[model samples]
Target: MQSNGPLYLLHQGQVVKFGFRVERRHVNPMDNLHGGMMASFCDMLLPLSVYRKDSAVGPRFLPTISLQIDYLAPAPLGCWVEGEAELLRATRSLVFAQGLVRADGVLCARVSGVFKIGPEFTPETAKP
Candidate 1:
């Protein structure tokens, strides 16, 4: 589950909503979500934002140069964490996005990220 690869390939869509049933394995010793898990969600958000509109371009598994997140509340085991990302801006070499994560219908995390578009990256090469 820690893998960077999308959990489900069909994960890229306009209304790309994703939810995962949190388990004990997803928890920290404190019975709350481990920070890394939430962090990973931030990582997933950007690539999805690009693919959601067009699956073959915009995102090339680019490395995030900067990622900042805020924990609004605790996320516990057995709760499904779900969220969406919206593209704030897009340029030839960068994309900015924001995302939210809700646990039990409460916003548990909010995030902002920037993706550095890499070489050979262009929307023209996109394929359905």
Candidate 2:
């Protein structure tokens, strides 16, 4: 998935917004955005919703525990995709999140995930 990125991010209070442009690499044979690409994008977006720089968790490295994605429609090639993610809940050791993926304002997919709260995040830990 690393090769599929250069994803753009925006912060809106408790919601994290991600913007992606569908490129040649992101599309399937039918010229629609690939399901795998959408899944990976949601996976990256969900954990970000739990980040709180001022809290004890404080931008921790979150390891995904479970992820579920529902494909609702196809995002055709060359379209812009936006993913809005928000935290559903957070416990002592886990965080749950949900997100909606839209292409040019039309719903394309729904996502939910559970992640394990891990060590504090650092640039070094983000490397593949």
Candidate 3:
């Protein structure tokens, strides 16, 4: 994830917004944002919609069960890409989320994911 660094997040009610600038490492040979990078960004960002500090589940690890991404347009180098994710539904054991990725307000990708709720997570448990 460090390779994709300098990620920023903003919480707005139930929606989570994320932003990142496209650097050289984030682009493909054609100087456009790489698809894999976009997918990884979505994977990391969408789960925030299911996170709640006051919920019975508390803070838990979310493991992706399925991720679907539709690429709509290209994001050129140096563009600032922004994304917004929201929880569509969540059960005790699963969470569903959808998100959109845009570059300078132009739609770039549409994403949806299903995540399995895992055991309680903390910084200690996150250590390798």
Candidate 4:
């Protein structure tokens, strides 16, 4: 969701700002939360957070080389887990991005990802 990302975007430079709400389905067993979801969230948003790009389909059409995640604390269910991304550095093809997810105003997870920027994607329209 573009709206999810870019919660507070500063169009002043090459970096884009974003955010997303972590729903209960994003939680894991043990009744706390799942690490995979946090990792996935990081993987999905980190690129946008840094590169200043806005297309969510970037993942589907573009490519992600890898995602590194670090779990810091427990993320509770039915709570709003917020995330933020910032671009640190980049090369011609390789770009680095890092982000964090917080629940109930507490730090829950940290993540970094490398991505290859490519052509943007647009969803195909369906005929009714």
Tens-place lDDT digits, model 4, residues 57-100: 24333368878888899877666667777765666666777787
How far out, in Å, is residue 92 in model 3? 1.6
Name the regions of candidate 2 deviating beyond 4 angstroms.
52-56, 123-128
TM-score of each: 0.78, 0.89, 0.89, 0.69
TM-score of structure candidate 4: 0.69
Residue 94 accuracy (lDDT) in model 2: 88
Model 1 worst lDDT run, 10 consecutive residues: 4-13
lDDT string for model 2 (5-72, tens) is 77888875554688789999999999999999998898887876557322555579888999999999
Model 1 TM: 0.78
Cα error, residue 120 of model 1, in Å, equals: 6.1
A best-first ranking of the candidates according to their lDDT comes to 3, 2, 1, 4
What C-alpha lDDT do the candidate models reach, one value each? 0.72, 0.84, 0.84, 0.63
Overlapping backbone residue pairs in candidate 4 total 4
Residue 58, model 2, lDDT: 54
* lDDT at residue 15 of model 4 (Cα atoms): 45
lDDT of 3: 0.84
